[model samples]
Target: MKATIRWAGDVKFEAESGSGHTVTIDGPPDHGGKNQGVRPMELMLLGVGGCSSFDVMHILKKSRQDVTGCVAEVEAERVDEVPAVFKSIHLHFIVTGRALKEAQVKRAVELSAEKYCSASIMLGKAGVDITHSYEIHEAAE
Candidate 1:
């Protein structure tokens, strides 16, 4: 619910979440940064993937799906302007399981995108052109 960001040096910042977790945000050397950590924009996009992945896993578990692994791969585009804000973002989920029902997997993804994932939903509401897609793979024996 709360967080703080402090300057760690030139073009670098450290963010501490309310839960006491910390992460470093830095830019490329061309931007006067040492490139010691993730960029702020990358972190923001990752947050959306994390939020959506959490929701999908939770829903699948609740439904008793035999989940083996899950990965949310994120991609984005930024406008070619001074601010360079995100213009669109896409999430491609690769879900693995044993005998995973296609309908259930589809439903889980839809639920996360439409109802549960707060980060993506918030960005969507802010006109960020958010989109989602998914593929299911059976676990290896």
Candidate 2:
């Protein structure tokens, strides 16, 4: 996995992944940026969310759950000190399916946080205090 970030002038950058995808990143207006795109920290949070969400959906599919939709909402807290590192992170998943089993959803979330999701594991190892919860909704007929 490789990516390149090029400075696009005044606290802005264009990042291109090895897979030929691109994203624009910029700082806030108070930080000499035009706020043209997502902040770097926000991207980090999204990465974790995406990684975990993918794992949950994959696990559910493998378990033969009639999954229809999955959404992950990620929230984080940062320290006020220098570096402003993540203090805590939480992921709330809304899972929709036909008669989704609570135990299956719970186990999937546990597996992602404890074993599968690389992003969450990395942050937890670095003392980020990651946590997760999920809600299962019955799919409409």
Candidate 3:
């Protein structure tokens, strides 16, 4: 729950989580940065995707679904003014499994978006429009 951000230079930073993981954050070249790493907003979008994906996978596993792989594609829009913030966010999940039940997958996605994904829910409550969708793919034989 704790993290530290150290200035690396103009528009660049090194962020270390309490767990000891680190990431480089920087702005684009035009923004006085060399584009060395992910932007802060990009990281936020990824966080939302990660949180929701974790819930979806956990729920599907506990339900005994034969999942083989999964991917969460996150997209977001920002307000067009100073202190620009997230205007909307969308998560598209691609799930692959063997004989995966559509109902089960749908349930998992719904559960994550409506109940389990804290990050997305928090953003939603903050007036950011949030949405979710999913697709299923059969594993190759």
**Candidate 2 C-alpha lDDT tens digits along 1-141:** 999999999999999999999999999999999999899999999999999999999999999999999999999999999999999999999999998999999999999999999999999999999999999999999
Give the lDDT ranking, best first.
Answer: 2, 3, 1
* Per-prediction TM-score to the true structure, in the order listed: 0.97, 0.98, 0.98
The residue-by-residue lDDT of candidate 3 on 15-92, one tens digit each, is 999999999999999999999999999999999999999999999999999999999999999999988999999999
How well does model 3 score by local distance difference test? 0.96
Cα deviation at 50, candidate 1, in Å, is 0.2
> What is the number of residue pairs that collide in model 3?
0
TM for candidate 2 is 0.98
- Best first by TM-score, ranked: 2, 3, 1
Residue pairs in candidate 2 whose N, alpha carbon or C atoms collide under 3 angstroms: none
Q: Which stretches of candidate 1 lie over 4 Å from their true place?
A: none
Candidate 3: segments with Cα more than 4 A from true spot: none
- Tens digits of per-residue lDDT, candidate 1, 1-141, equal 999999999999999999999999999999999999999899999999999999999999999999999999999999999888889999999999999998999999999999999999998998899988999999999
lDDT of each: 0.94, 0.97, 0.96
What lDDT score is found at residue 110 in candidate 2? Answer: 99
